[model samples]
Target: MLRSFTKYLFAPALALAATATTLVVAAAPADAAVVSVRVKGSLAARTGAANWFGKTRTIKNKQKVTVTCRVSGQYLRGNVRKTAQWDRTLIGDYISHAYVSGNPKLPVCAPPAPAPVAAVPMGPTGTMTNEQFLAAAIGPAQQSQRDTKVPASVTLAQAILESGWGRSSLSANDNNFFGMKCFNNAPGSYAAGCKSYSTQECTAQGACTTTVATFRTYRGSVDSFRDHGANLKSLSRYAAAFNYTNNPNQFIAEVHKGGYATDPQYTTKVVNLMAKYNLYQYDLKV
Candidate 1:
């Protein structure tokens, strides 16, 4: 009776071992099939992980390459925050021309924009009417006197100067309004006399240098304006700039002091423009 009991227990144990071995072999093929491709570019502020830009490398059954986005800037770094994933073919839909064409296979993806942040309410400020796209060059400001920070305004002004009313080759062709660099991701160029921030000196140094940083050209001016604002809103370091978020002019002044614009008259120019054209009114409804 004791020998019979021992045989029954041994049979179950052997069967369990065989089952485990079979499962391991079946899963082995998947490990070899998985391959990952890392594509660097800004998709949002919160995205920094290796796999955020594209789909997972462990493709389902028979999928091809997986793409990921890594978007960074001098003051801003990491993958774009809150990006929506897309197939590899649609990847170029979000990236600038210069970056998208670099790899035809890489898909472009865009981050979901946050809910519209209200500035102040303005009642029909009237239509824009300036030659040379002057209003376009000058950005919007807070609608009231209570807002704080200047980084966004200051950065906008600088971008205006750098891109020459959004007409620069980088801006017009690539939608790169900031002149940010492609870092090590691609071979990029610059206009003569353009300055680039050094990796050691810049705050976000994922291959970003001050010298003619890469920029993304957009479908329209609205896209550029929106992206510029989103970029500022994403970072914590620019909190001081956002604190004055209610006051567009104050925000411009704050940004100048924040070291956004190097020009000594940066504040004066932005303030003058704001008051002259009532650009601050845009903030009211924004």
Candidate 2:
């Protein structure tokens, strides 16, 4: 009976000790000056103090964001998420403190304003002909189709949709036709680093918001194609999606389930692009 009681108390006692240690360290002096912390890399600011929380937004590399408070949270130290200290921002989101360095101590913040919902844009953009875009991307798509089990149609379609028919600046300059991220487990051959570009995203509820962010930049579009394949193959979350070969709809739907892209109509758009372009025929040949 005594052993059972001691075992039950052990966990709570450890938790309390951890919390007390954190609270003591974070308690600011009365004259402490508040300051901003520069992000060492792109950081996801979560809705709460846990990695499981929704990423409320992102902070850019080397950008200084004002820290309002500190709390203990879970952060990925390499592949493992561990209990560690976190810093809250003026936006009321929590970022793992490990992502920031070279900053002064901070003060507890006032209750922050609720994060505002972002707007969505509905309908068409640009006047680039589909043939023009298809012509540019088909070469890499065919090669990718052969190499990865991903259909050329799906690859081409995702490129067309994400890159605005190769008109988006990330495609034009960075050769990042697919908007892949540097933070992902991309093969080193393709994962050079990140590039900042203004882009749009949609919530699951279909509300769209425009924001600028850094993504994996590449020497050419082929790298983007290859990395897209790598992402599907290497990431465990995408394994189920990668297995549905030759079926574009099932393949895209599975990737979508793994949260490949944010546009509410992503799979629909890819399917439409494939249909409109006879892109599936290449899959048969390649």
Candidate 3:
């Protein structure tokens, strides 16, 4: 369910943005105020199967340059440049590693595949029992007693919650484990979605109707999982969750916090279900 990414090339701390540097200004025509230039390390191209739009740029070190301070959209999109003011601090913390201090001559390094946040507990296919899965899933949770991170198990847990152990009508008939939806006017049989009798829908009057909406269908469970991870990685809100990839319980909790599900007890139910099936064991690996 994970995609490979390139490793970021790094130089010595002095060459990187570990410390602040002076800004330099270049002489322009009389009409133009001298443009400001800042010394900073440039980033190289990023390579990851996950869809993160990042680019490389060089910021000078100790060199003062002049430029307009009010420039917006100067940085690349999807690379912390498009975030709102509130989210800037959060996004910056994750990408700060790409910059260097002294402007050392460093080359671009490819991103590497993300490691599993936790191990997936499994047993022999034939003789394997649910008990084994339970034991394996709890190992990682016990090793790291916390639930504020994102773990691989959390992702699996979400799928199980949405798909009902691959037994839901959506999962059984459409392979739509995550229950995604299209715009209301979407075409084909999905226009109305596979509604359920007891499912509730909201109306303009703010009243609930017993009309369950149709969930989007997928080609397979693998597709659901891949897209699920990609969706999480694409959004800025889930950025912090990636750091907690080593802990599934925390990861699941974060996803819940991120509003991954609409259920009132989404987190509680997910945790309970994982324990019931020993699913936490799946998140114990590196």
Candidate 4:
């Protein structure tokens, strides 16, 4: 489920201490400034900037909470105001700025540094070589097989075909290697969120159309791989594929027959890739 940005109204403020005990801020830079703000109403403080994250505590009305920095997050409308700003507290919890009464200015939290990119062996055309892509994918594919009883070869082949060897923008930018669409943004699911993209989809009759759609987003490629296996395992339509876990070709054909993709040749394409690349060697014995 998408995080609920709905703010709940509570009873009027009670007669309590104006301030609570000080809390040491976490994840703030040493020189970062701290500010205190009274809670306008009872509200939850979350572990992350987004409401989807776990709730840390419920801060009652009129309580003074010390905040270290601020960052843009889920838009919230509360008693004090409406805003996308979230205040990071001394206790490292995130509270919606819309619930805080004080107008104290806070420093913008520094954006997390980008993850270091690993240098991969590039082909003559300056793209990741097919061999290099397979090398990187083998571990995740086999792990998925171990976890879901899906053939590692089928997983690797799907990754290769769907992601274009990690060249597609979705795979490169969002780590969504399987082009997995978001049917439901359920909390604690493999999907962290959804991202919109333009894609070409085909009908059973081979009629194709370009359309904009929302696809599932993952924290990393490993999550994408895991989700792919779990998705196949969970769906009743794809259950027959599990019967052929030791046969990558038969497994992928069953997946295609179950309408995993609209393309009529989806199974052939995946199987061709597997055969050409000797992907069956990666399949785990079920």
Top TM-score prediction, candidate number: 4
Over the stretch 105-143, how does candidate 4's per-residue lDDT look in tens digits?
688987869999865322111146877778888888888
Instruction: List where candidate 3 sits over 4 angstroms from the true fold.
Output: 1-150, 183-214, 284-286
Point out where model 4 deviates above 4 Å.
Answer: 1-127, 185-188
* Model 2 weakest lDDT span, ten residues long: 17-26
Write the candidate numbers in order of decreasing lDDT.
4, 2, 3, 1
Q: List lDDT for all candidates, in order.
A: 0.40, 0.68, 0.44, 0.77
RMSD of each: 21.1, 21.8, 20.1, 17.5
lDDT at 40, model 2? 45
Model 1: how large is the Cα RMSD against the reference? Answer: 21.1
What is the TM-score ranking, best to worst? 4, 2, 3, 1
| Best-performing candidate as measured by lDDT | 4
Q: What TM-score goes with each of the models?
A: 0.36, 0.51, 0.40, 0.55
Q: Poorest 10 consecutive residues of model 1 by lDDT? A: 19-28
Pairs of residues clashing in candidate 2: 119-208, 120-208
For candidate 2, give the lDDT of residue 171.
Answer: 73
